[model samples]
Target: MTKLNLLLVIALLGSALVLVRTSYEGRRLFAALDRAKNEQRQLDIDYKRLDAERQAQATHLRVEQVAREKLQMRTATPAVTQYVGDRPHAASGVAR
Candidate 1:
């Protein structure tokens, strides 16, 4: 009877230790998951902000402004326009 009781007590202690260790590991994993979720949220916000900035930079007005200011480009006008063809008089429809 004494030996049986001692063996049962040892088994119970071992099971209790395992349960405590598992619980501690679970809490640690939960904390890591929370930190990862926060990081993901921050990354998502940054991506959205960058996408908005990209859209603003790609706008037509912004492109034209950059072209005119930085590239020294100008809009085409009739006075500056030129026409070309295979023959000199091909566009005017006059026989050579």
Candidate 2:
């Protein structure tokens, strides 16, 4: 009878150990999943911010401002422009 009791106690202890390990692994998995969700949320926020910045930079007015301010460029005036090179000229009197 004492031997049977000892065997039963050992079996119960083994079952308890298995249960504890399973519970621990489940909790760890849940924690990792939570962390991943938080990271995804943060990345979404960063993407939105970058999209807004891109939109602002791509505006027509912003492009013109950058061109004028950074490159110091301006449109051509008719008084300062001239047309040339419309008609072809004959070659000089030299053999080919």
Candidate 3:
């Protein structure tokens, strides 16, 4: 009877230790998951901000401003327009 009681106590202690270890690990994993979710939210915000910046940079007015200021480009005007003649072969609709 004493031997049986001793065995039962040992089994209970082992089970308690296992439970404690599992609980700790579960809390650690939960904390990690929370941190990952926060990181994901921050990344999402960054992506949205960058996308807005990209859209602003790609606007037509912005493009024209950059072209005129940096590249010295100008819009086409009727006074400066020139007409070109098509190739003779193209006009005849035959391959050369």
Q: TM-scores across all candidates? A: 0.78, 0.74, 0.80
In the order shown, what is each candidate's alpha-carbon RMSD? Answer: 5.5, 2.8, 3.7
lDDT of each: 0.96, 0.95, 0.96
> Model 2 off-target regions past 4 Å?
1-5, 76-96
After superposition, candidate 1 runs with Cα above 4 Å error? 88-96
TM-score of the candidate numbered 2? 0.74
Task: Give lDDT tens digits, candidate 3, residues 1-96.
Answer: 999999999999999999999999999999999999999999999999999999999999999999999999999999888989876753666667
User: lDDT tens digits, residues 1-96, model 2?
Assistant: 999999999999999999999999999999999999999999999999999999999999999999999999776899777878668768889888
Whole-model lDDT, model 1? 0.96
State the local distance difference test value for candidate 2: 0.95
Per-residue CA lDDT of model 1 for 1-96, tens digit only, reads 999999999999999999999999999999999999999999999999999999999999999999999999999999888977576644666767
